[model samples]
Target: MSERQVARATLVVGLLALTVLVVVLVPRDVVPGGPVTPAPVATVLSADEVERAETFSRWARTWSWSSLALSIVVACWFGLTARGRRLVERVPGPWWVQVPLAVAALVLLGRLVTLPCAVALQRLRLDSGLSRQAWTGFATDQLTTQGVAIVSTSVAVLVVVGSARRWPRAWPAVSGSLLAALVVLGSFAYPLLVEPALNDFEPLPDGPLRTQVLRLADEEGVHVDDVLVADASRRTTTLNAYVSGLGSTRRVVVYDNLLDSASRAETLSVVAHELAHARHRDVLTGTLLGAAGALAATGLLGLVLAAARRRGAPGPGEPGIVPLGLALVAVGSFLVLPLDNAVSRQLETRADVDAVRATGDPAPFVSLQRRLAVRSLADPTPPALSQLWFASHPGVLVRVAIADRVRAVPG
Candidate 1:
């Protein structure tokens, strides 16, 4: 097959493979439950929790549909415009030229997609969690950080494309090599540079619960030195928590939204889920996987852009390149997000199991999960496909089932 055809086929296959891998990794069963704890403590939700949940639901509906519409429009435009035809018709260039352009286009496109969503997200009166700084930080954090890689790769793409008309056959090799080099360099730097920053939030205390959580981690042979509670409610009403940082900085963080809304049992359950990540080392695994996915997408798209440039098609302009990068990254990230979350859910499942295992009580975990489901208005039993693609935590029904199943036969 011709080089362009080959590049297109390769892109298709790689994306499909990644998507399949992500789908395959979705956790199907609960992990082994750990020690259980007693007491089904309940806590009342403040007005803030209710407000945030309501806001989140609205924002979710808006952004989800807004972007979905934008995607359809963009796709239709690409289709009607016969944009791909020019790339297809161009004589295949050297591997280097073709590859670099494609990668640059991909990276540029990936970065661009964030802008609209960021804008759409900002339009809402959502809380400021970490996302509060997303727009302003985009220049430094995402654009410049990952943006530089994208721009560098794009420049290489332009050179390849520029060389193609004069030296079509020579274009591919140069483009490919450049693309490869860019990907390799980016793989290492992106993580170190973009490691998630600790957003403004209240610090955790030297309280009993704090001590107990760490003590429990120690019992499981896990070293967890930091625990933080983020004022996530400032960003959005989304009820969420995550364990961020690496090695010594690794911390289990709770969303203030969760803290205020969840009962003590529910709050502990959230923390337990994060603890599972630390205990099972899922955080490290996720960080590595996320970085790898970014690299792979960057490389693949770079190749396509290189080809387009060689053919004299206007290399996707900054406007176009940015969106393309966003599309490709979103596709790649979405494909893997489920598996990433599934890995997380496995640890979470284990933590839930651990909660039971530690305290011989499953009720608290069950209650916590259920309350979250109701309060968050989460679709507890979404279609398997939807859940695989979107859920970051196990569904409430699944979590509750695990709790019930464990109670029937405790470890």
Candidate 2:
């Protein structure tokens, strides 16, 4: 088969595989008792609280969307134009050295363009009492994040460029498979390698809360190693908890703010939600689906770059392709965001269900949701499209309604 034909076939097959995995693995009807009808925001939150949430969300969303749009525009400018190619060509180095330098330059340039929006958002968070992090901390966090991005993207670009140079015709399939494997490896290693860079974690300590957490995990049939508390209070006042890693690295981490601010019952309610994720292996499911998505995106990228090459653009192995590759990835990730979030919402909702069921107490679950929304100043009634596109978890009102339904159902 022609190389073009092979690229097309790969794209089609990768997309089909991604679709099948989503259909089979994503939970549909995991919430028991009955369908949940979300209660009105006014029913739970005061008018003042709702107004504050709406205002915060409005400004936060504006800044967030502005940053995203600006980044895309900058990426396209650097990726598709003659000026961009000239910029990369001006760098004096071999392809190996030039690729990483070019990637860093383009990535940092994009960040520079969006830095104002980031600062604005951070200011908003500070004013709203959501973030406790100071300017120096924020700067440090941004650098750390960009450093990780540059390193990971450089490695990916090197592999792709290397593959193209080695096998002109089969690079798409080879690189796609390799990248897919890397996604799994990244998922497994993220908790160990990345989490430590941002915060310090200590065991939840021996106490009633620890005992209950362990006992609860036992009841849920998820293994209990230790619950770790993150030094999240240094960064933010918002309460949070999550289960991360896979297999041996698996851990349940709670924000220290949560332990200090919430009641034990409420804390257990959150732990139960995370335990549900562990019990169902949601992380593994997400990792596998992400690997498939990455492979599909690679195939799509191959086809697009091939088309560009026919139109006289640089070949895949050229340094000029670096910006274009990054731009394509940014655009592809944006386009697929809603679908990704849709699956995330389903999984999160399923976890919520398990949280209430395992705890067998809807009161704490309901209160916990309310407290989280209040603490985070979350808009209980967000715009429908925004929620559909970006919200990873079910809104607080819907979660409260789910708890109510579970409580109403006869045993």
Top model by TM-score, which number?
2
**Candidate 2 TM-score, true structure as reference:** 0.98
lDDT of each: 0.54, 0.89
Per-residue accuracy of model 2 over 1-411 as CA lDDT, tens digit each: 655776777788788989898888898876666568898878889999999999999999999999999999998888878767888998888999999999889989999999999999999999999998999999999999999899889988988888888878888887888888888999889989999998999998898889999999999899955699999999899999999998888999999999999999999999999999999899989998988887788788888999999998899878889988988888888988999999999999989888998889989898888989998999998999999889999999999988877777623
Worst 10 residues of 2 by lDDT: 402-411
Off by over 4 Å in 2: none
Clashes of 1: 60
Model 1 gets an lDDT of 0.54
Give me the displacement of residue 125 in model 1, in angstroms. 7.7
